[model samples]
Target: MTNARIAALAALGVGALVLAALGAPPLVVAALVAVAGALEVVGQLGPIALRSTLRTPDAVSRAAAAAAALAALVTTGVTAATVCAGAAAVVALGVVWLEGLVGYAWREATRVVERLPGYTAPHSLGARQQVITAGWYLAVVLATLTADGRSGELVLGLAALVVALGTAAAFVLVTRAAIRAKATVTARIAQALRSYDAPVMVYLSGPEGTEYQLGVWLRTLERLSVRLVVVVRETALARVVAGMTSLPVVSAPAMADLEGLQVETFRVALYVNNGAKNGHNVRYRELTHVQLLHGDSDKPSSYNPVTAMFDKIFVAGQAGIDRYAAHGVEIPADKFVVVGRPQVADIAAAAPGAPLRTVLYAPTWTGFNQDNDFGSLDPTGPAIVRALLARGWTVVFRPHPYSLDDARSLAAIEEIHQLLEADAAASGHEHVFGDRASSTMSIVDCFNLSDALVSDVSSVPADYLYSAKPFVITQVDDGPSDAFLDEFPLARASYVARLKEPGSLEAALDALEHDASSSEREAMRSYYLGDFPRDEYADVFGRAVEALVASRCPAPAAPVPGTPGGAR
Candidate 1:
C-alpha cells in the first residue's frame, strides 16, 4: 500500500477504537466503518478502468480491509455494552475472513487459467470479482451497523448475512466458469493446430509494451503467399496480436510449451528484435531462423554480435551488410539478403517549393542502457521545435513511444506539446501533437505530410530517406565530425544540427529552405533503401521470403514400403 493509504487505514482504525473507548454513540462508530468500506471499494476497483491488463487486489489490501471491518464490529459491540452484540460481532468477523479467503482463491484460480496456453483471461473476470468483493465489504458494514441488541436488529443482521453469503456464492460460480471456459478454449486451439500446416512462422517475444516492434512487420507478413503463424512468448503480447490481426497467434511462454506446439511443417521462423527470449526459439534447428531487425539505423543494435545466431539476416540494402563490417561484427556473406523495406513503399517523394513548409521533429527514445541513449529530446528538443515555429513552419511532433519510459523524455515531450498547442491556437498554424502525431499517424504518414525532417540518430532518419527530402540529424555533442559522419553515413547527405552550437539549428533550417542537399539525399536514398522501384519493393521482400521457405522445406519422406506409391 502507498503511504497515503496506510495513513488513511491507521486513522480509520484508531478513530473507531477511540470512539468506542469514549462511549460515543453507535451511529458515529458505524459511519466510520461505512467510510472505510467505501475506501476499500475505491482502492480495489478504481485502477481497473485505467489499465489494459488484469489487475487484482493484492492480499495486503484485502487484509487491510478485513482489519478495518473487524475494528468496526468490535467498536459497535463495545458501544452497545451487550453480550449478545459481542457474540454477533464475533460471528460477523468469521464471515468476513471466510469471504476474504474465497476471494483470494478466486483470484489465484483466474491467474492459473490465464497462464493456460491459448487462453486470455477476459477483463470481465477481474471486474466481476472486484464488484463481488465490494458487495461483500458493504454487507460486512451493514451487519456491523445492525449488530446492536435492539428489537429489529436481529432481522437486519440476518439480511446482511444473507447478502454476504450470496456474494461468496457468486464468486465461486465465476471462478468455476472462468476455469471451464479456459479449458474449452485451450482444447479448441489445440484441435485447430493439429490440422494447421504453416510453413512460415513469425516468432516474437518481448515484454508487454514491445508489441510495436511486432506490429511493424504484420502487414509485410500478411502479403506473403505461404501460410504463416505468429508465435509469441508473452501471453499479454499474444492477446494483443490476436486482436491486431487475423493471423493465428500462439503463446508459448516456456520451452516445453513451445515444443508442445508440434509445428512439424514449419520451415522458417522470422524474428523482429534481438530480445533475450529469441534464444528459446532459435534452439529449434529444424526451423531456419531469420532476423528481420525492426529498422535499419546507425545504432549499435543494427550490428550486434548476436545477429550471428540467425541463419539469415534480411536488411534493406547493401549499407546494412557494410554496417556489419564497419562495426567489426562478421557473419558469412551469403547469410545477408537485401529485401528493400516494403513498409516504406508508400512514402511519397518530397515536393519542393511548397507554399507552406512543415517539418517533422521525431526524436528517438532512450534505449535500454546509457550506451544506447542517443535521444536529443532532453536538451535540444524544445529549441528545435521553437526554431521551426519561429520560421513559420507547421510542426508535427512525434517522439518515440519508448521515450516516455524516461521521466526527462516524457517531460520534454509534454513541454513540446504545450508549445505546439499554444502556438496553434494563437497563430492558426496546423500543428500535430498528442495522439494525432504519436498514435493515429504512422511515421510514413508523417513523412508524406511534411516537407523536411529533424530527428536523432535512429531509424526515423534512416526511413525518412525514402522521401529523398531534406532532413536535419541532431547531434547532442559539440558538432558533427569526420568520425560521427563516418559512423552514421546517412548523415553524409543531410544537414547536421549540432545542438551544442548556438545557431546550428537555425542554420540547418535555412539550409533546408534552399534544398542544398537534394542531390546527396537522392544518392543516399538509393544507397540506404536499395535501388528497387517503389512499386516493386514489397514484392521483392515477399518473393525473397517465399524462396527461403521453399529452400528450407523438409524433404518429403520416402513412401512407406508396400504403400500405393512405394517402389514395391
Candidate 2:
C-alpha cells in the first residue's frame, strides 16, 4: 500500500486504541471522523466539475480561504499538536519525493518527444503535490474509520467502504444520466410540439404578471416576426392556454411523457431563470434556453457554478459579463448577447400617472453571514421616505426578503422600524408614514414611477439604471477589502459612494436628489448599454435559437407521449 494510505490506517488504529483507553464510545468517534473526512475529501477534490472555456481566479480569495481554514482548525482543537506535526512531516516528505519523480518523468518525456517527430509524450505532475493530495484523502478515510471504529471490525470496514464507493458511484452516474437525459428529452419534446412559422414562446418564471408581460413584448413588437406560445409554471399553464386561442402555451410535461413527442420545429424557447428547476427533463428538450433574469442585479444571483447547463445567456449589459467572469462562472462569452434590460424597462413604460417623482429605498436581504451596516449607511431610510412623502415624492422601501421577521407579516414593517429607530430621537415624525407594500409590487410598479432610487448594492438599483433614473448607492463599509472588492466590479456602471463615516446620509441623499439628472443617467447608460445595436437583438438572439432547435432529432411520425412500444 502507499505510504499515505498506510499512515491513514495507522491513524485509524491509533484513534480506535485511544477511544478504548478513554472508555469513549467508538461509534460516536466513527461518525464524527466520517463526516470530517467526507467534507475534507469534497473540499480537496470537487465532486464533479462542469468543463467550461471561462475560468479565472479572484485575487485575495485564496488568502481568505486559507484564513478561514485555519480558523476552523483552531476552533476544533489545539490538543492535536503532536499528531498534526507528525502528519505535516509525512505529508511534506511525501510531496518532495513525488515532485522529484515528476521532474524526472518530465525530463524523460521531453527527451522522447524531441527525438521522435509527431509523437506525444506523457506529462507527469510533481510527487509533492501527489503526496499532499493522497495524504489528505487517506487522512479523511482514516479519521472517519477511527471515529466509528468501536463497531465490530467486519461491520465498520464494510460499511465505510460501501458508503465511500456508493457515494462516488452515485455522483458519477447521476451526472451521466442528466447529460444523456438532456438529449433524449429535447428530441422528444420537439417532436410533440407543433411547428409555428415564427417561433414565439413566453419564457417566464416568478409570478403570473411577469409571464403575461413577456407574452405582450413578443406579441406587440411586429418588427420581429414571432408567434405566441406561453411557457409558464405548470399551475398557470392551463389558464394561460385557455385564454389565448391563437397559440398554444406549453406547460412542462411529466418527464416520462417528453420522450414521446412527434411534433417539431421552434424558432425560440426563451427560458426565464429558475423555470427549469421546477420540472424534470425540461432542459434536455432541445430548444435554446434564452435566460432572462427576473431582476437586473449586478451581483451574482443566477450565476452559480451549475449555470454551465445553459446553451446561451441573454445578459443585461457588459456589467453582467464582467460579474460572471470575475466570479469563475462559466458562461460562453461568445454565447452571451447583450440584449439590454427587457422586463424592467417594459414595466417602467407601462406605469400610468404624470410620472410620479419617487425614490426607492432597497436594501439587500440581511441574515446569516450578511453585511449588516444598513443603519449606519442609511440610518434615515424612514426619515428620507417621510421627507420624500412630504415633498410629494413617492417612496418605496423594499427591504431584503430575509429581513422579514417571522412574526411580522411583511418585511416592510421591520425594515421601517430599523430605519425609524436610527434617527427617531431627532426626526420627531417617526410615527408618520404612508401605507406599506412588498418590494416585488414596488419593482413591478413604483420603480418606474420614481424619479430617483436609494439602495445599498441591490439589484433594484441596476434595474432602475435601465430606466435612466437617478440612483444613489449606499456603501455600508469604510474601505474596499476582499469582500468589497469581489462585489464592486459588478456595479462599475452605477453611481456609488462608500460611506466612510457616520452622518453621511443627509449629504448622500442630497447628492442623489441634486445629481441624479437625465444627463448623468444617460452617461452611465451609454457606457454600459453601448455594445448592442438596438434593432438587431432579436436577429442576433434568433440565430442562436435556430441553431439549437435545428440540431435536435427530427420529430418521429405519430409518436405517442411515452413508451417505446407506442407509435414511432
Candidate 3:
C-alpha cells in the first residue's frame, strides 16, 4: 500500500472503533467495514473493471449494503440490525463476484494448469470460476445466519436471490443452444454438399479472422506432390483459391462440416494454432495431424502446451527440437522433422555488399494485449532510427501490421515517417515508407533491400537468419530465464540491444558492418536452422509433408490433452 493509504486506513479503523465504543449498533460497524471494503476494491481493480457491478447482481448488493447502513442508524432492537448486517455481507460478496465476472479476471485460473506445461486442451475456465464464486457466496451467506442476532427474513431473501440468478443463467444457456444448433446444421450442409478429397488438408483453423499468416504456409507448400486443400472457417478467403494458391479452399462454417466430410480421404491434417475448430479436426479417427507452426520464434506461442497434440511438428531445425524438450513437453524425437523454412528461399538474399547501408528497421507488433506485446516501436524505434540516420545509413522503417492498430503505436510510427519525410532528401539518404506508408511492401522485398535486421523477439530474426546477414534483436525486458535465452540462441548470436539503449543498435550494426559479428551471426544461424543445402528449402519442406502423408500416423502429446480451453 501507498503511505497515504496506509495512514488513512489506520485513521478509519480508529474511527470505526470510536463509533462502536459510543454504543453504535453492530449493523453500523458492519456497514463501515463494507464501505471501506468498497474503497479498497476501487483502489485494487480501478473504476473501469468495477463499472459493470453498477448494473449487475452487484447493484442489489450495493442497495442491501445501504439498507444495513440505514438500519444501523435507526433500528434500536437486534432483529432489524441483524437482518441488515447479513444484507451487508451478502451485498459485499455479490458485488465482488459480479465485478470479477465482468472483467474476466477469473480466466487467470488457467495459469494454475499452465504450470503443468505442454499442450492441454482448453478448459471451461470462466464456467469453473462462476461455480467457485457461487460456492463461496453460499458459504458466506450461511455463515451470516450464525450471527448473535439473526432473522428468518434474511434467509428467505438470500434464497430468493440465488433462485433468480440460477434461472437467468439457465435462460442464457437456452438461447445459446438455439444458436449452436443452427451453426451445427449449417456445418453439416457444407460437408455434405462438397465432394472434396485430398491427401493433405492444410487446416486454417484459427478464429474467423487472423488467417494472414496462413498465406506463408500456403505459398510455401503449394508445390507439394500430395493433393493439397486449404481448410478455412470463413468464406471471405475464397479469393485464396483464386489468387494465393493452386489448391481448392474448403470453408467450414460449423462443426457439422467435419461430420459430413470424408475424414478418411486426407492422409495429413496440418494445424497451426490450437483453435477449438482445429480440435474438432484432430478428433478425426484416421488423419495424421501435423503442427506446422506459423513461425519459429522465441515467443511463448512457439512452444505452447497445445503443441503436444500434433502427430508431427515441422520444425525449422535443432532449435525447435531442443525448445519443446527443454520446456518439459516430452514429444517423441522422430516427430520433430528438420525442414528449413521453404519461405526463406523466397526471401531476398543478402547482396554482395550488405553490412553497412540500407538497414531494415522492422520491429514486431505489440501483440493482442500488453502482456504478450514485445513491440519496441513506441519506446525506442525513433531514437534508433534517428541514430541510424545520423550514421548516414539509409533506413527503411517497416512496422508490424498489428503495431499501428492502436493510437499510441500509430502515433509512434507517424513520428518515424515524419522524420524520414523531412530529412531523407536533405541528408542525401533516401528512405522508403512505400505504398504511402502502408504494410503493402512485402517482407521478402524488405529483406532484399536491407543489409541487416533490427527487430524484437519475433519471427523476423529467425527469417533473417536464412539470409546469412547481420541482424539485431531487442531484449524488451529483463527477467527472461537462462532457458529462454538458450532456446533463442539468435539473441546470444546477434546484436541484442535493450529497448532503453539506442547505442546497442549502433554497436551491433557497427560490429556486423565492419567487424567479426558476421561470423558469429552465421554460426548462430547454422545452430538454429541446421544445415541448408543451397536455397532448396522448398524441396526439403515438400519431402517432410510427403513423409507425413506416407506415414499417416498421429503425433503423441496432443495439445488437447483433454482440456476444452484448447479450443479457440
Candidate 4:
C-alpha cells in the first residue's frame, strides 16, 4: 500500500480512540465506524471507479482498519455495538484471506495443467464472497443505527455472530471445491498431452511484459506446414500466448517439467529472443535449435554473442549475415540462412505527389542498457514532429511500446501528442496518437499511411525499407558522419537527421519530398530484405522450414524385438 493510504488509516484510528475517550455521541461513533467499514468493503469489492485507487488490502492494512472500526464501536459504550463490529471485522479478514488462497490455488492448477483452448477459470466464488462480505458489513451498520434499546442491541449482536460464522463455513466449503476442480482439469490436460506429436516447438521465455517479442513470430510460424507447439517458461505467459494463438501452449517452468512433456517427437525448436530462461531448453542436444530473431536491425542485439548457441540463424537478408562479422562475433558462414522478411510483404509501397504528406514519426525504445540505447524519442522526437507540422504535414506519432518504460521518453511522447492534437483541432489536420497510433494501427499500418518516415536506429526503419519510399534515419549521439554510415550501412539509402544539427531534420524532410534517394532505396531493399520475389516472400520462409526438417536424418528404425539387444 502507498504511504499516504497507510497514514490516512493511522489518522482514522487515532481519531476513533480520541472520540471514544471523550465520550462522543452514539450516532457520531456509528458514523465513524461505518466509514471505516465502507472503505474496507470498497477495497475488497473494488468498483470500476475505485479499481485504480483501491488495491487488494494487505494484512497490515486490514488489521489497521479493523482496529479503527473496533475503537469507534466502543465509543458508544454499548455491548451490542462492540460485539457486532468485532464480528464484522473477523468476517472481512476471513473473506480477504480466502480470496488470496483461491487465487494461488488457481495459479497452481494452471501450472499443472497445460491450458486448453477456451478454458476460463471460475471467478464466481470470489465474487460471491465479496457480495456476502459487503452485505454483512451493511447489516451491522444498520443494526447499530436502528436498534431502540438494550434488548434490541442484544438481538442485533446475536444475529451478527450467527451470520459471520455461517459465512466463514460457507467460504471454506467453496474454496475446497474450487481447488479440487483445478486438480481434475490438470489431470485431463496431462492425459491429452500423452499422445501429442508436434514436430516443431517455439520456445519463448522472458519476463511478463515482453510478450510482444513472441507475438511477432506467431503469424509466420502458423503459416508453416509442420505441426507446431509453443512452450513458455512462465505460467502467465502461457495463458497469454494461448489466448493470442490457436496453437497449443504449455507452461513448463522447471527443467524437469519441460523434459516430462512430449518433446522427444520435436525435431526442431525455434527461439525469438536470447533471454536467460532459454538455457533451460537449449540444454537439450537432440533437437535442432534455430534462432528466428524478432527483428532484423543494425542494433547490437542483432549480433549478440549468445546467438552463437543456435545451430542455424534465420535472418532477413545479407545485412543480417554481415552484422555479426562487423561486430566481431564469430559464427560459421554456413549457419546464416537468408529467408526474406515475410512480414513486410503486405506493406504497400508509396504513391508520391499527395497534396498533404503524412510523416510517421515512429521512434524506437531505449534498449536494455546504454550500449544498446538507440532510440531518439528522448532527444529529437518532439523537434522532429514540430518540424513536420510546421511544414504543413500531418503527423502520425507512433512511439515504441518499450519507450514508455522511461519517464523522459513517455513525457516527450505525450508532449508531441498534445502538440499534434491541438494542431489537428484548429487546422483540421487528422493526426493520429495514443491508442490509434500505438495499438489500433500497427507499425506496418502506419507505414502504409505515411509518405515518409523519421525514426531511430531500430527495426522500424529497417522494416520501413520495404515501402520503397524516402525515409530519414536519426543519429543517436552525434551529427551525421562517415562513422555513422559505416556503423549502419542501411543509412546509405536514407536521409540522415543529425541529432545536434539545427536544421538537419528539416533538410532531410526537404530531400525526401523530392524523392532524391528513390533509386538508392530500391537497391538497398534487396540488400537489407533479400532478393526474393514480392509475391513469393512468405513462401521463402515456409520452404526454408521444410528444408530444415528434411535435412535432419530420420530417427533410426526401432530395433527388432528380442534380437541383438533390440537392434533390427
Question: Which candidate number maximizes lDDT?
Answer: 1
TM-scores of all candidate predictions against the true structure: 0.79, 0.47, 0.61, 0.78
Provide the overall lDDT of each model, using Cα atoms, as 2-decimal numbers.
0.72, 0.44, 0.60, 0.72
- The true-versus-predicted C-alpha distance at residue 197 of model 2, in Å, is 7.0
lDDT (10s digit) by residue, model 1, range 194-229: 557778878888876688898888888887888787
Model 4: per-residue Cα lDDT over 1-568, one tens digit each? 2335545544554454456456555455456546655565554442111111124433334334444445545545556545665666566556556555555554444352334443444333445546555554544444444232344666665665666666667657755765786555444444455456567878988876577888878888887888777888776567667777877887776555576654456778899999898777878888888998888999989999999999989999999999998999999999999998878888997776554378898888988899888788886788788888898998998988788767999889888988998899889999988999888887788999988888878888888999987888988787348999999899899998887877777788888777767789998999899998888887998898878876764867877888776934
**Candidate 3 lDDT by residue in tens digits, 262-284:** 45567778876666667777778
What lDDT is reached at residue 75 by model 1?
47
Model 1 stretches with alpha carbons more than 4 Å out: 1-63, 78-188, 352-356, 556-568
Tens-digit lDDT string for candidate 2 (1-568)? 2224434544543453344345455344444334433433343331111211111111112112222222223323333432342233233323323333333222221221111112222322233222333343343343233333243433433443443344334434433444444444434334334534335454444543334334434433333334445544433333443353344444433333333332344444565555444334345455555565554454445464455565566666776666667777867777676766544434442232235355666665542344433332234444545555555454566555444432332444556655554434544433322244452254546565556777766556666655666666766667663456456543444445555645465666566656635565556564444344445433544454445555553656775657676744
Which residue runs of candidate 3 sit more than 4 Å off their true CA positions?
A: 1-196, 207-209, 235-243, 348-355, 369-371, 434-440, 479-484, 553-568
User: Which window of ten consecutive residues has the lowest lDDT sum in model 2?
Assistant: 51-60
| Order of models, best TM-score first | 1, 4, 3, 2
Better of 2 and 4 by TM-score: 4
| Candidate 3, residue 375: how far the Cα is off, in Å | 1.6
